[model samples]
Target: MSRQGRPQDTRKVSGELFSLTYGALVAQLVRDYEKDEEVNQQLDKMGYNIGVRLIEDFFARSQQGRCHDFAQAADVLTKVGFKMFLGVVPTVANWSAKGDEFSLILDQNPLVDFVELPETHQGLLYSNIICGVIRGALEMVQLEVKVWFVQDQLRGSDSTEIRVKFLKKLEDAVPAGED
Candidate 1:
């Protein structure tokens, strides 16, 4: 209900808020960009920016420590992160032999509720922002990763599957002028 779902919060935003806000933002992006590819890129960029901030708040509120490995990261993502933010925990599957890649099957996507992609946006992945969010969030915790939507229910697919590939851990660099 509440965007952050704080424990003491009794008030809640309408369920349609997520869908309507996303739809309106996408529509505006399409109008302003005038190209599906550009719109998708912009959406991803926007999502990345949001993710960068969201992770901080998530960490502060969830009080979760650093993930030791990709497996632990995946568990935290699907079990804790998704449940807290989206109110639904996606199923994680299709793990790679090396355990560096896996797919999250989203049985329900609040961002796509009561929405339909028009013919003009045929190639658009409406829920691509979620991929960007995952990548951005992981990057903040020093985990460099690549995330994309493999299947989208908005495009008439049976389910939404987001594929995440763990690339490498990024090192923290000190600023030249900093202590």
Candidate 2:
């Protein structure tokens, strides 16, 4: 009979494998797109799709409950979400006067650990997918936000920073066939 004591734990992969695979993917995208802006947009789009689905999994696995405000969401994103998924927890800082914007600081980025952006891809945002992911996740919860990477160590920045701006809350719209 199968072991029935404790349930199977979550799957984990080596950081090296993850870093290499992700770096290769980005490199290929850059080669195919042939333009920094195009590559960045494509990466963001892909990340948005991932984020849309990832939010559901995050809700189920994390069991953190609903976030009532931006602060709570920020906490969950930096503390629980990043820590669990990436094994690296980002710090949330640089709050705006109106509390509509903040910066998520990554002291260490696994995605860029072995990544080096060539001179040709100078303007390209290598980690743009992260911004898209954050935007997608927040949007899924009705918090329309703008997320973009402002600093990237791959491009010679000391630390990576993602700027998140709270645009506006989305209103639930009824489906056409519902009523």
> Evaluated with lDDT, which candidate comes out highest?
2
Q: How accurate is candidate 2 locally (lDDT)?
A: 0.85
Clashing pairs in 1: none
Tens digits of per-residue lDDT, candidate 1, 3-96, equal: 4755655445656987899899988888898778888788788778777777877887798987888999999998999888888899999999
TM per prediction: 0.89, 0.89
**Candidate 2 structure quality by residue, lDDT tens digits, 1-179:** 45578566559776788889988998899779878999999989888888887888898898988788888889999999899789899999999998889999999888876777788779999889888888777778888899888888888988899999999998983121210
Cα deviation of 77, candidate 1, in Å: 0.8
- Separately for all candidates shown, the number of backbone clashes (residues 3 or more apart, or on different chains) is 0, 0
How large an RMSD does model 2 have? 5.5
RMSD of each: 4.7, 5.5
